[model samples]
Target: MSKGERMKTTAREKIKQQQAAQRQREKRRRVVTYAAVGVVALAAIGGGWLYAASRSQSEEAAGGDQAPVTVQSDGSVVMARSGVEKPVLDVYEDFQCPACKQLETVSGQTFKNLAAEGKAKVVYHPISIFQREPTRGNSLRAGAAARCVADGRQWLAFHDILYKNQPSETVEGFKTNDLVTWGKEAGVTSPDFEQCVTSQKHAQAQLSYADKVIKEQKIEGTPTVKLNGVALEGNVAFTPQQLRDQVTKAAK
Candidate 1:
């Protein structure tokens, strides 16, 4: 072969080798990029799984057939005797509701007195209706923590504490730590109760129960009071004395 032809042939072979090397480098780079992305995706999924499992475990630990509070078929929490002969008062309230706070302040003691006297049975259904932006699920958190308090048999006291320390509606209140602190103040010294409150073990279940009650009862707002299956018109429709009168009448 001619020397020029030989030179051209060698140059062509060198160029082919360079192109193959470049292609291999690009392929390796793509593999590395895909591998990194896969790792990140796996990490995110694993983290989510771990979080979900932790929540599930906490819920399992907090729930049982012997729970202190009554869990209805629809998940409502009932605070009264199952077959009490006294007049029944069903109170549906949200922890984040200012109106509920007023109602509690106005008639909480009255209701407690009636219940203690066997004149009436108060069934407190802690529903969550104030779940919105900025509040960041404060109502749900409070409701769930209230369940934990109920488990500790301090529902009424903790209920009062929550309302007394209630914050404004425009911000996130009733954080987990705050709830734990309030539970302690309300005589909930059990470590299990503290764990339940802090971990929000029943948060999802509480929310589900609230949703079920809201849908079934068509509850549009908080502080809905039903006395012997009759709904009250408003907060001031019946004063504490009048409520006591009605309960006395119903018991007859």
Candidate 2:
């Protein structure tokens, strides 16, 4: 080919390379701009979610429509009698806890029997993990309702029902409505009990109790039993003999 023709072809290829480079630079700029917008959008969404979460928590803390709870003087429910001293067994439990149910059905009865016989005393320090799955009693709500029902006369029945219906954590089967029906079946006559359960107002005091128990009692797990401040670990299968033995050991 002639020199002039070859020179023209080379110049055209150089111009094509320049155009490609400009297109590449523009593409890079567009991608960077898109990424910045995405980051900004994500930050906004995160902020909104955080705000909503805080609001929900605040509502739960307020526990609308529930009456206020008065903390017991000794921080326990075990009755104290003059000159009796009532050798105390303090129990911290979660209503959803299966092991807690075991402790109740097997060992708590023995302790209650002893208390009934005036041989000892028992104090229940219920820790509310009410939101935890399998909380058959929906104890926080139920306890609050029962408090309204028995007017403080039959808290024990409320306590029993909470444990009796504890559902499995693996599945969702416990009916909050059924708990109210159960209370009525047990002879409690409060019409507003169901409302309290639905509103989750009863959980307020329970949440407060949990905070106190964790901070003061240093409780890390459910079904923790303490006799005069000494902690009990394991299921502690409740039989008259086992409870009697543990109590005897703790008393000493």
TM-score of each: 0.66, 0.59
The lDDT for every candidate, in the order shown, is: 0.74, 0.61
Each candidate structure's count of clashing pairs = 0, 2
Best by TM-score: 1
Indicate the TM-score of model 2. 0.59
Q: List the residue pairs that clash in candidate 2.
A: 106-238, 107-238
Q: Between which residue pairs do clashes occur in model 1?
A: none
Candidate 1 segments whose C-alpha is farther than 4 A from its true place: 1-83, 150-152, 236-238
Question: Could you tell me which 10 consecutive residues in candidate 1 have the lowest summed lDDT?
Answer: 58-67
Candidate 2: lDDT over CA atoms? 0.61
